[model samples]
Target: MLYLSSFTFPNDDMEFDFFMKIKRTCYDSFYPFKVLSRHGFERIDFEPVTILYGGNGSGKSTALNVIAERTKINRDSIYNKSNFYSDYVDMCEMHLKVDIPENSRIITSDDVFDYMLNIRNLNEGIDQKREKLFEEYLDAKYSSFQMNSIADYELLKKVNATKSKTQSRFVRNQLMGNVREYSNGESAFRYFTENIGENGLYILDEPENSLSPMRQMELMKFIEDSARFFGCQFIISTHSPFLLAMRGAKLYDLDENPVEVKRWTELKNVRTYYEFFKRYEDEF
Candidate 1:
């Protein structure tokens, strides 16, 4: 789980050089020329697991997307570096030894929602097709029993009447079976657990999106187990202390000009959670 060396990107257009190493680490941003790095932070190398922490619009998601896109990791979102007033864009030359695992994949809330919607739509379409098939069978089989003038119509009705209600029932059951039963957060965590596998690099963007604190902790444990027992490597962007505090997780504060790593307890988001939890400690 350790990367033996480091690399530098000589030609990146973000007004700085990109310095990184491969050592079970994560870097928020390593634009080495910047003076005002977040929390006096600089590029960080991580342990097998890493977390990126920052506030809204602090570039946490942006950094995650960059890593995912740069590493050719499967992602739910497109990465872009648009310049003002033109279709031309800036691209980064990334350096690292990380290779994406065949079994590993990125999961986003957007991807999950779209997947569920597609399943729903597919089931609906199947229902429609089944109805049409039943009507057609009725028309073809019962045509001879009706009066000549309306024989075709009557036959279709008769055919439909003969169809086993069991067919419809089976189709309906299939449509409803195995459908997502959990809340969005629960579903997301479940999906994360299901998707991650051994010896793979997974880049997750804001995995905490739909998870409750308890679910987030569950996700944290899942990630820990995957990394420890399965040889899985993770690069995650999130503000969840539950995840950020994962044993030995490296953190990069993206709010700085140049991203850098600090202890989970030192992160602003973690501190906020700490203060809030402490305030309610007496009541509990």
Candidate 2:
């Protein structure tokens, strides 16, 4: 069920009416990265868990970024274009399903560290604010003892209660975690689990960059559960056979003239891995 579909023209060519169609009844219509000009991929069809496969510079990342920016969809792809070209970005016509949830957010390897930093900074700021408010509250209460304004007394009580709630957390911090604190592989896995919450669409770009085989499998399980139980959808771009092989994942081989779906075992990357491993089969 393709919900929304739109395309972008090259070189400020806005006259061309790119076809955008929404088919499904289960998702929002986000903008698309139009097939303005792709060398290997011919066209694209969105899927629940679409996986893009190709060698470096095959335009997989480029396409992902376009979709992300144009549709205001979650994005984790590596490369991005300048804002100057945003207006010309391909438009999206999507199957209008669920309202885009506010908690839904885009996550990328590049931003993992930055997101953690922001959380940390936000928590620190919250703490400082809480302390300052506490001091103000104390002063207000003391002033109320000498003054006779019932309104001031009420304000003082409200501020003190608010400060108490803010300081109740064991961490006394708003931001509870950081990616840098975990190993590279752990960081990636943690991000996937923590960010891919209920009923949201998540786009992952080469999530295998920092994950081990075990962790990759873990990601597969997480993805499955999220989609099955939490109403989550995924659009990923990667070369990892582990992720490509996820049950029911729709794969588009960017190496093809017109991008086409294929079984995981049939993918070039998977075949190459099979051949390489076959050589050491007897030794193992």
Candidate 3:
């Protein structure tokens, strides 16, 4: 299940050396270089499921991006890349147990959001077509013009078809079905399930963004099953307790100055949630 056995990022000393070599002063920052090294997050040892847990700007996403770039995995959205991004990736290293499958990919929050937006746009277009189809059906069904020649062949067929079928059925036949059946949360969950296949390494960034609590639990179970039964591995950056609590997932606390692995229950976010609920235990 572990295609990427381990990965190493550039440390502060290496970042400093790289900066020392650079003569360009126009660029204000060398991004990914200093991001993870600042927190002493220089390496990740993989498992069936590995989680990078942290608050915003804790380098969780930066680490994932570095790994994804180094591994050369497929990704949909365009990520922020500084002028030195490639050079930074070159300094990093990865040891793989097996060849990374071509289907392996990194899924970012932007990718999921774009997917939902695309679906919404497509459905809007389809709705417009449906309205036009309805009008066409009524017009064709009521038209009294007789087909005098082969020039009217297509129109003749449409007229006959509309006459035999009801308005809804006629319209349905003319247009494709709407693809916006699911809510945003359900759509986001569906995006993961649809993209993830067996025997592939997947990196998911903040997958809990669009999901509700119930949906988050559903996604957690789905990921657990993928890793357990299917030949799959996951590297996820998330603050969701549901995902952080996945069975047998190794979690690195990026919030720590020196990143450390800890149990899901021990994470600050999870503990905060536990305390909040415990304070009002009688309500539930």
Candidate 4:
């Protein structure tokens, strides 16, 4: 299930040395250069499931994007980067167990949002087309029949078909059905299930964005099974405890000064949630 065994990036000292040797304009800011270089983010040891956990500005997403870029994996949405983005990527390397599958890709919040939006937009268009189909059906069904020319053959066939079929059947025959309707959470979850495939490596950025707690738990299990049963490995950046608590996942606390690995229960984000729920335990 593990395609990538290790990932190495420039350490703090290396980044500092490179920066000192090179000259940059005062206006040019290398954002991740400072943030990711803080710890020994120089090397990351990956498992079937590797998690990057941290608060905002902690460089977790930066690390995932850097790895995705370096690996030239598939990605749904474009990740934003500073001017020094390539310079930062150049300083990173990976050791792979096997060639990364072509389906291997990175999924970000923007990708999921766009996917849901596209479904909604597609359904709207389909609705309009269906209305037009209704008008066409009525016109065809009630039209006076007079096939005098070859051009009228098409209308003659449609009239015969419409007369034989019911209005609902005629509309169904004329138009494509709308994409299956789903709520935001259902749509978001569908995105993952549809995009992720067997024997592929996936990078998920903040997958909990639109998912409710129940949906998050479902996604947690989906990811767990994907790694365990399917030949899929996942590198995820998330603040959700439901995802954080996936059994046997490697947890790197990016919030730590040195970015050390820790148990999920010991993580600051997880403890915050635990405390909140524990304080109101009796209410439940």
Model 4: what TM-score?
0.89
| lDDT at 122, model 4 | 94
Q: In candidate 4, what are the lDDT values of residues 40-133, reduced to their tens digit?
A: 5667899899999999988888889889999999886876788888888887889999999999999999999999999889999999999988
- The numbered model that scores best in lDDT is 3
lDDT of 1 by residue, 17-114 (tens): 22332242354533322322333432446567877788786755555554554455666644444322011112334445655455656666677676
In candidate 2, which residue ranges exceed 4 Å CA deviation?
1-36, 40-43, 74-80, 90-95, 115-180
Candidate 2 per-residue lDDT, tens place, 56-85, comes to 866676666655665576554345444334
lDDT of 3 by residue, 1-284 (tens): 88999999999898889888888999887887778887899899999999999999998888999899889999999987898899999999999999999999999999999999999899999999998998898899898969899999999999999989999988877789998568899999999999999999999999999899999999999999999999999999999999999999999999998999999999999999999999999999
Better by lDDT, candidate 3 or 1: 3
On the 0 to 100 scale, the lDDT of residue 210 in model 4 is 90
Which is the leading candidate under TM-score? 3
RMSD of each: 7.9, 9.8, 2.0, 2.4
Residue range with the least summed lDDT across 10 consecutive positions in model 3 = 172-181
lDDT of 2 at 170: 22
lDDT of 2: 0.63
The Cα local distance difference test for each model comes to 0.61, 0.63, 0.93, 0.90
For residue 158, give model 1's deviation from the true position in Å: 7.6
Task: Flag regions of model 1 displaced more than 4 Å.
Answer: 2-42, 79-99, 123-180, 256-258
